[model samples]
Target chain A: MKIYFPNFFQALLLIVLFTGGSAAFANEKSFIDEIKGADAPFDNRSVKLVRPVTLETVLAKEEYQGGAFRVLARKQHIERYKCSSCHVPGKPVLVQQGFELTHGDVVINHGRKGNELSCIDCHNQEDRDYLEDKKGRKIDFDHSYQLCGQCHFRQKRDWLGGAHGKRVTNWAGDRVVYNCASCHNPHSPRFEKRFPATYSVPLN
Target chain B: MGFTKKDKAEKIIEDVLEKPSSRRTFLKGASIAMAAGSAALATGCMPSGDDSSSGEMQLRWQEYFKKHYRLMTQKEKDETVDRLERLAKIQDDIDVQIGTEPPIENVLYGYAFNISRCEGFMECVTACVKENNLDRKTNTQYIRIFEMEPGKLDPSTGDGQFYHKVPVENKFYMGVQCFHCENAPCIKACPTKATWREPDGIVVVDYNWCIGCRYCQAACPYFGRRFNWGKGEVPKEELTTKQHYLGNRKRPMGKMEKCTFCIQRTRKGRLPACVDACPTGSRVFGNLLDPDSEIRYVLKHKKVFRMKENIGTQPKFWYFID
Candidate 1:
């Protein structure tokens, strides 16, 4: 006991130094949170008080940059939306003059190079309007990405995480990205080789 | 190899006596002559009248002597931009807008090229030419998409002049542009303090400050810079009216210009023309600081490499394969 604790003031000093220093370090560590992805969802909480963008955040009072972004809706751009318009309820086939003219040319080359799929594989045979997943869950045309995610899950993961696809309009505010169907045709996905376009064409 | 006094005197005499000199020496001599002439003209050269012609002359006078874009304050920038707009209207009958938008905070821009996706369509080249007001007469292109075979990724082994159908079997495409290197040798090579990197990692050249020495062109390992051989003319109607002071604005002949990642567009939160125009979605651009940005995701999840990265250029531009 004597060897361990001779001077009371010295003991107090050591205790104060160790405990106080450790507490400060713990606080700093929690604040910084330098772990792999403490800010994975990227809420901007880890962002310290630095930029003038802080002022914009305070003024806008909204979702921070890179926090809330969405995939652009494809329903409006789709030529044959509300598939119920053509494929009426309980009608096996609408067999109209314009129907074949509009969509008769859609060739199935989607999975020709790999695990081949038929029309009924991804398309719901029961309902012509909706796309079904492997589990037969109906996915809206607007959210066809959900249908795509069912098979191409790797690409889906990257697309959802802000890679593998193009962003539209702007980069900063309300990041809107393109859906898979926007670039790749649902039926024929392969791109053909073509002559490169140029504005000047000076190299002729 | 050191220059002694005798050698220095001989070099100076050679520099002065050389009639048709090198591009660098010519620019230095011309600038000195212009300075002397301007000093003489500074005292009451113009007639004192508010005539429309006098007003035009006054604008020209200020423009000819305007300070470098970097040194100008916000008010000075606005004044210069205004003066330039007026001068374009009066001299060329072209309505133009020159902006001076500064770099945004926390927004370090980066670009990613998907080597697997690019079909060598040259659409980015077309878009860059139109968007950046490139010299149509000379067909000055800022972006070059090279058609390369599968072996080596080096551009020298690739062909940029392919006009045939793209995505030729067993061939891949790579793009080359001003990499906007963090340690840009072009910036160091510039004798005038004209070319410098913006805060957002874009290396920009102040056209007014450039003396047309072409040192930056020779200094770039990627052969990225373009020198204006002559005034590359664009039809007045074909001119892109919206311009940035240090970007796509009409450039006088003999100055240096290169890609600014479409600064006028990118600064406004829009994608660069090349990225937007790519049909294959091969070009990805976004803020490097944002972890959720597509560029950041590519940097994390993709197999990536940079051109001449071993030279310590530290280019923000990266090429990747899925």
Candidate 2:
């Protein structure tokens, strides 16, 4: 009789666990739908035309070498991680089960009170493929500069004017510049302090 | 041997003078005879001291008699380029391209340095050295980055030889090169008109015409010139085969050289090597006539200052703080 009661309770628990998991998944889908329907202020089109005439465009037109603009897509760089492989399409939990994070090597020392900010703050919650702007707009990984420009408007203005950031490829040709993420890691935006190249010897 | 050769040459000149026709013809014939006698004597003495081949000798003579770069006709310039290519092939066994690319119209090059951003990387200095094909033996670097203390405007007090970790406490870096000043004292100092400012505001030196008097060097307040005391030691493998006639085509010993703002690259709408090499985006270069250029923007917005402004050299290069 004792063995029979425990066996009965185990069966009941299994049924409850399966049903609860499926119900939670259904709720998560509905939540994603609700978020998608919400109005986002910024779109890809608006983001692109924010600055009409950048310093790069001006220089590029003057030189006019039939150059094209290019940027590295985030998906290309972060494909190995496979965030969707472990993370389900729903709100993230404080602690995940059956998934051991091996990315401890990534150090985040950016922003005030760095530990308070998490990956989800800048990263999209519903979609792992793109980043999220303050207005909850889905930004492509290639256009992460737009995401960075939200809070760093002054820097963005200077960068647009050619006062900050580095220009890649030919300076006079088509203006293909490196994204902000190319030089500074989004998690840790500050440049690492290191020694520069060797000094030139002076004529004695 | 030298005394007998001189006597024979003199005797030939005397004979030519004695057989005088009209004044003009006699003088011309006499000069021609003297030249032939001297040429024969030189060939005779070749075995003793002259190791150069006859082809090389002819090339050297042509190079010596070549007109100034600015004055050379198109045909003369083409011939000179051919001669230089052949000389490079014969001497170094390397194929070299020497071209004369003129400056673009309505383009006066200007440079702006952001003092706040320069981290004393010295990348620009090395790039300038390699691109300009400067003499490594004499450490002929055209650019100097001065590490100066904050709250100080005196460049004389800055240390150019600091070999420590850069961005030192309370210090900023400022780089100086040939500013190509409008009121250039060096141009005024040249006795033979070997150096002059181009239409594009670049002060260029005709290597063949310079007499190496060092007058320009003395007159430059910014120490913007270098004298080649010995043959420039560029490794055969490291030789930049792409060269410009008045720019980096290997200069001979005893000629004064200064920066031409990378004429070979700039004339083709390409940034100078230093500008491309800078990692910090501290150096800005553009056409001063372009109202929308980065350099023009910096000039209009930033608090720009020029070195030695009191002296009124009117340098095209400007320094600014963002």
Candidate 3:
């Protein structure tokens, strides 16, 4: 129909088309944005907050083996450090160093027989200071995790991944955790059963 | 004994009745209006010294009318938290810091308990009670450690009160608290909207908004909620001064409360008191969304299961064994 139309009608048609096109454009862009947003993963490191209470220092930490945590150094907390001060090479040490005198209360019951694994198996006999791994590699007292990691590799892997051991004080920031000895008595690894601190049947 | 407007009006009526003169009736009506005006004036100029009367009456009034914590603006939250701390100082003489830190963005908390590792020491129980300031008189613990036998994963079939020794022969220990379920039934059951799961997945209760109806208590299948039957009694010395508005500040009597995963500590990047207190290192808590977190490792690598998966609660809590 070749009927004449006012100029206003033509402009109105353009406005309608442009408005509808803009809406479609926005929807198309928004759909892509939604997909991208869903794909983007959130990282825990985005949290900048650190633990207010910590027993760890940056001076002594090893980034957890390919993990997102740091293991706190243990040597600083070790009692009777500098094993060399009390022991000479090829000499009996536990008695002379007052290790037995001071720790007279503790008994080493880790293995079935004491002969299977002696102090020198883990503790360096040649150098009373550094701990010895199974391969006779000298491990720093601070890094005794490497020593414990040998025999109890499963626990070591979990500890490194932060499933088997204790986190120091807080959960976030500079993720520093306690070494194996912090919870387990290295000499006597098994925990003793004891009475609960508070006991009440919660269920009525 | 306080001079209220009603008391003043009663006195004015008594004086008018004692005379009973008909001519003064019109004047009595006029005088009553005057008394009303004066009563308003008197109250407007009331002494500031009355503020010292326990400070609780004022706090209680504000607390009574407060909006649900989720609906409150930051400013309103701050005002209430300040009033609560001041009330504690005035009434109990204990200086408490009530934190109102909101959930961190993009973080969802999840907890994992190692069934193979928990030794039934109840260290978590002791730490939870001390940390949350639970009722000393009643010993209302939020976390219950059940001594379970083989093939019995249910709490009803277990013993929560084997006090003789932990890790009993042929038995394993299981600790149950609020799993902070993804689809929490308690939140759905609450008539007042007092309890809700935060963005971080830790279900919290606004202490003031709770109506003490205990509907949530009845609705929770895991027995995750507790009703304060009596006023929580913690010795002034034993009370934990560090508190959270939605956590273990000071619970009102008859409100439903459950484990908030130690919101005061957790929101600040600290582990829950129970996790920190465990001698066996069984409890693991972290951001659920974070793939590298210990909890995620436990979920992905270990044979893990929730308490009642068939109910479709989708609890963030999981139990695993070595």
Q: List the residue pairs that clash in candidate 3.
A: none
Stretch of 10 with least lDDT, candidate 2 chain A: A42-51
Docking class of 1: incorrect
Q: When superposed on Cα atoms, how far off is each prediction in RMSD?
A: 12.2, 28.5, 12.9
lDDT for each candidate structure:
0.75, 0.71, 0.77
lDDT of 2 by residue, B51-162 (tens): 3455565565566556667666788999999999988887878899998877665566788888988888888988888888888778888888888999876667889888
Ranking by TM-score: 3, 1, 2
Docking class of 2: incorrect
Across A1-204, the per-residue lDDT of candidate 1 in tens digits comes to 786676886889999999988865554333113222323443223322211121111111112235555565567776777666766767566457545746777777877567667877887877867888889898777677778777788877767665577777566665667767778888877777788996323231
Give candidate 1 misplaced runs (Cα > 4 Å): A1-67, A94-101, A113-116, A199-204, B1-52
Best by DockQ: 3
Residue A176 CA displacement from its true place in model 1, Å: 0.3
Q: Put down candidate 2 lDDT per residue, A23-70, tens digits, no spaces.
A: 655543442243233333212121122122232221221121122344
Candidates sorted on DockQ, descending? 3, 1, 2
Cα miss at B301, model 2 (Å)? 1.5
B1-322: candidate 1 lDDT, tens digit per residue: 1113325644564455444647746565666576556545653475655345556666766677666676678999999899989988887888998888888766678899999889988989988988888888888999988889897899889887788887899999999899887668998898876888777778999998899999999899988899876686887777888889989998989989999998887787778889888888889998776677788788788898999877866677889987
Cα lDDT of model 3 by residue, B18-44, tens digit: 466665556556665655565455556
